[model samples]
Target chain A: MDERVLLTGAEGRVGRAVLGGIGDAYEWRLFDRDPPAEEHDHEFVVADVTDDEAVRDAMADVDVVVHLAGDPRPEAPWNSVLTNNIDGTQTVYEAAVETGVETVVFASSNHAVGHYETERKPDLYRTDDDYRLDGTELPRPSNLYGVSKAAGETLGRYYHDEHDLSVACVRIGNLTKGHPPIDYERGQAMWLSYRDCAHLFERCIEADYGYEIVYGISDNDRKYYSLERAKDVLGYDPQDNSAEYTMAGEPKSDV
Target chain B: MDERVLLTGAEGRVGRAVLGGIGDAYEWRLFDRDPPAEEHDHEFVVADVTDDEAVRDAMADVDVVVHLAGDPRPEAPWNSVLTNNIDGTQTVYEAAVETGVETVVFASSNHAVGHYETERKPDLYRTDDDYRLDGTELPRPSNLYGVSKAAGETLGRYYHDEHDLSVACVRIGNLTKGHPPIDYERGQAMWLSYRDCAHLFERCIEADYGYEIVYGISDNDRKYYSLERAKDVLGYDPQDNSAEYTMAGEPKSDV
Candidate 1:
């Protein structure tokens, strides 16, 4: 509610989703490398996450940090991921610890464990497949970008254990704006609705977990990521399901 | 056994262990930041692992790369780990892929999953306790150094999946020269004898695996890390056990 939260990568898609749904929930400090397109009620700080002094300054009075800043491309080069994702994440964690920030809700991606889908593909995406990755599994990254995300998760674990920071890594899925991707079974299976994303992050800010990894997908019938940890730990009750929509990305009721 | 092996960090402890025992087994190309104090048969190249061109050059005509180069300190700073460990590992993986290297035996650390011992401490170190970390579990790093190792493991996973380079991460325990650690239950529990260390790495080079995380410890009776994966996959048969040593670290037979 009244806790001052720092949202890095505030110009990204996930940032927008979080803000659009829960814009007025918390007193927010929006941090991004790019300047805001339009003005807002929240204090927008234009600075890169890699800037240690800037990040520490921004976290002066913040209670929580929703760290979403990084190179989001799955095919990003090693240097880009190392600098933006891995180094930037370490900077955030260090800053949080120094400034006595209570919690950090890291925006890890499905790509962190993307290689798990290599052997089990179309079948795993279907509703009939009961196999699930519930965040307890080791990261089997498929790319350099995924490696960086997994690195961020490991950094979170370190900060939590050493510094007593309450850290939660949300392995976010495909987050489209209005609905899930059309005819993409994998996307549909791991779809995270805008509202659900916001609510899950809200729970992250509000919850009291020491260190946790939870999938950030909605309650979908055709899902490979189990949401039990998220539900139990963060009290996240997602409203949308990808199965409720038609194969063409339209709501079944609308069709 | 005559594979042209590139042993990174050839001047380090693990390198010494490998070279001491199995030095005659392979045609070796030793790569290290520090020049060797004494050298004879092997072609020694003194270069930092972070140096991309040097690493790539070192990989030329190399069949197997035992990549042990990095910041070896468990309490190393973030920058040190980032540059020497994480970035250096990426460089090795990239070079291996480019040079058509067959396998990379990564030197991961027990520190990568050190936090697992937080709840179950002294008890977990005992022979009576059946608790174990089997390498399939997610990394729960306790320090920046450990985080870097975990990051390296993720990088290996990525290289194996995307580039089809065989990778085996050896989560090495506390490797001592001749005997188990003295008066330290935790260290003794996961002690890795020098000969066993060399033999285990030899197995890593010989055996084939797509992507694996195996504990690199001797056959200790009071072990927390399970050696089943190593035994099954890499045919690692360690002969040393800490239980054979006295509490003061002397050999029971000699005493």
Candidate 2:
């Protein structure tokens, strides 16, 4: 728990969730394109992920990198995603290997396999459906952004195979604070509570794996992404479930 | 086969194979970064695939595009692959969508899933070992070049899903002219004959598929990469088999 973890994109939603839940768990070096509003405990570095020198400098003495920095937009332009997501991820991997970083927990998105939802839409999102997409399936991206995420995952695979870098790509689901998404069946099925998100990423850092691709969702009842890999490989024991929340995003009574 | 086909990277090896075999079949618009040394039977245009305007211009009135343009080297650097392979592919997809091109036969390499051979080594290259990697398997790239190819495949997936354009990725094996590779079991296992390579690309242009990833190897007996998808989907009837050749790369005699 005392490993000096370099958390890129430290100001983003996923970054905030990881820090908010497990801020005290690790010796942190936070990196982001933007400066922190107010500094507190961890060392903060304001630099773009695509900046090779800055990323290498940030990786100095860092054991693990929770690489979450990138263009996160689903509809992001090709130029933006290519530069920020694909290129930036490459920079991180190159830096990590050069500076002797042990592991990289890449924040891959559900969009990497987003087209899997195309054929099996409303039914796949329902609790009655038995179909699921584990992490082993080929990427069928639905957008340029998704393509970028898939590219990032492939980059991780390459780095691991070539340089023996321990890499784990968390194909993260719909992470929402407090409750699941309101009235959205797909969102509900793929919902990841903030606490579970933090826990999943925590396991990713702590786990000893050569390379892995795992779904980063809570134990949702109406789910298509299998959490078996995450549970078995990363020892990720998620405590939250989307089924605990009503369709209206309200907490259901335990009665 | 009289469709106005735009052939990118017309100067490369695969382009030569296709044109050499099926030169007179299609009304061709040849495109390459380098100008043809001699006069071609078809119209040729010199332009980079990364140039969006140039690609679109080349796509004008094109019914099919045999996109073979990129850094072909397996050891190509990150910047080269990023720009030539990934960015160039996006540009092709964009141009194809914009200019109403019907089909794209992408020259994807076996390197896209090269790491699959890592654990299974020389055994998987033998005829007795039935371990096969069908098209449905996820990418396990071993190098940066492989990563870029996988990224291109993902980009094709995105374009097919979003724009309804037909895309077929031919994960081509080691394409050698006349005979199998000399004393390389891995190469012999996945060896693609020049004639078979041409026919495969022809099938890619002719047959109908929404989006597909097919092994472009010949009917090699010592193969781990399956050609069933290609045969079933694209009606790819390959003629040559590497098993007909000796380990020293000589064609076996029929007693």
Candidate 3:
């Protein structure tokens, strides 16, 4: 598709992942609070997501926005999360609607439903356990950061209903680079390989929907989050599995 | 009970309703942006809900908080709702935890699930429909204000799980003083009398719950929201019914 996509927090890990995979796929308008260390293919706008005027300016002709700009700390204080994550997300959504941006792919986190893991613990993360949390479950944020992400998801829902904007919130899991966290049960269950991450977001941009929420994780045998919604709705075909990366963090070549 | 209840937005409708019914029951620390027109019952603190320092100061020694301070307008802009509703709520929750406040009774609205009314409209409002929306259903906010209320509910959930702060989010319906709305099918189905409003908050203070959401409408026959959770969990015994009032909204003398 020849869409003019605005990637907020372009310097962030997720933004970079998308860029590395599909930088030439769309006309990119990269936005971040700080300028990139090395620039390249797309037009970049260095501005805080909370700055409505700057955000609105960048959103002028955007078709889709992959909004990943926020204070991504699980232990973030109320002030930081309120300002950077919650307020900033609201600004992005409002500006997107104002500038007539078609779709917004919000980067929601697993922390939005983190408390579920707290209760279930070892059983939930184990390879044998089959219990799964689809997007249908109510939000039970573990912290202020999670609360802000949930708020962002809610905002997307609101904007979609109120303004007819298409929104897809991706509740991203343990997104470590190259390999999943070594020998961590919880990490293994919720791991999202870099390629899968890029492909999931690509589906977000290409998919047609009103308001949707799908878990962003690779196919894993020890998973608690169901990837059925993502596959069925977004046609997200994730190739890499956390099981491929062994307990010692080495990639297993053969069956 | 002999609790020191700090009622924020004390001069507002919900606050006034609570005070009108149970003002003398507690040691009241009434805080609001505007001072009451003529006050005589409790110690009042005049400050905006957005004023964190003032809110924190007023929260000291408070047992429970009935946080109703927010831009209650359904058509509220992003800026107003963002500041007054969302951020203000976060401050209240954070301060409640900081000051060792026992519970927070958040005044969430029926608008949090208003979209359910959109398609099922006219028919859903009928007595024969039998379709009810219990508190268990996910929020489907119809407006920005509703979105903020949903966010507040989510905040309460987060605070409850992470900090162990007891919370009850009352998804209040049409709260009309004295009687129910006449001739309006939707209004009659979700009417909340002033007496019930006061009693609900009273239960929020008296009863115990980890985290919950209860519809705050009275025991109306033509109700769309289920009062099962409220009655069972919070000991909410509402005495009034919208059916008691005539279509003209006048109370029948004989009945």
Off by over 4 Å in 2: B247-250
Q: For residues B135-208, what per-residue lDDT tens digits would candidate 2 score against the true structure?
A: 88888887888899999888898889888999999898998898999879988899999999989988888998
| Rank order (by TM-score, best first) | 2, 1, 3
> What lDDT score belongs to each candidate, Candidate 1 first?
0.93, 0.93, 0.90
User: How would you encode candidate 3's per-residue C-alpha lDDT over B178-248 as one tens digit per residue?
Assistant: 89998898889999999999999999889989999999999998899999999999999998899888877
- Report the lDDT of model 1 for residue B159: 90
Q: Where does the lowest 10-residue lDDT sum fall in candidate 3 chain A?
A: A155-164
Cα error, residue A153 of model 3, in Å, equals 0.6
Per-prediction DockQ: 0.85, 0.86, 0.75
Provide the global lDDT of candidate 3 against the true structure: 0.90
Candidate 1, residue B63: how far the Cα is off, in Å:
0.9
User: For residues A1-255, could you state the per-residue lDDT of candidate 2 as single tens digits?
Assistant: 689999999999999999999999999999999999767599999999999999999999999999999988999999999999999999999999999999999999999999888888989999899999888898988788889999999999989988999999999999999999988888889999999999999999998999899999999999999999999889999999999988777889999
Q: Residue B205 in model 2: shift from native, Å?
A: 1.1
State the TM-score for model 2.
0.98
Candidate 1 per-residue C-alpha lDDT over A132-213 given as tens digits, one digit per residue, 9 for 90 to 100: 9999888888788889999999899888988899999999999988899887889999999999999999999998898999
Pairs with backbone N, CA or C atoms under 3 Å apart (clashes), candidate 2? none
At residue B46, give the lDDT of candidate 3.
92
- lDDT digits (tens) for residues B27-57 of candidate 1: 9999999989886589999999999999999
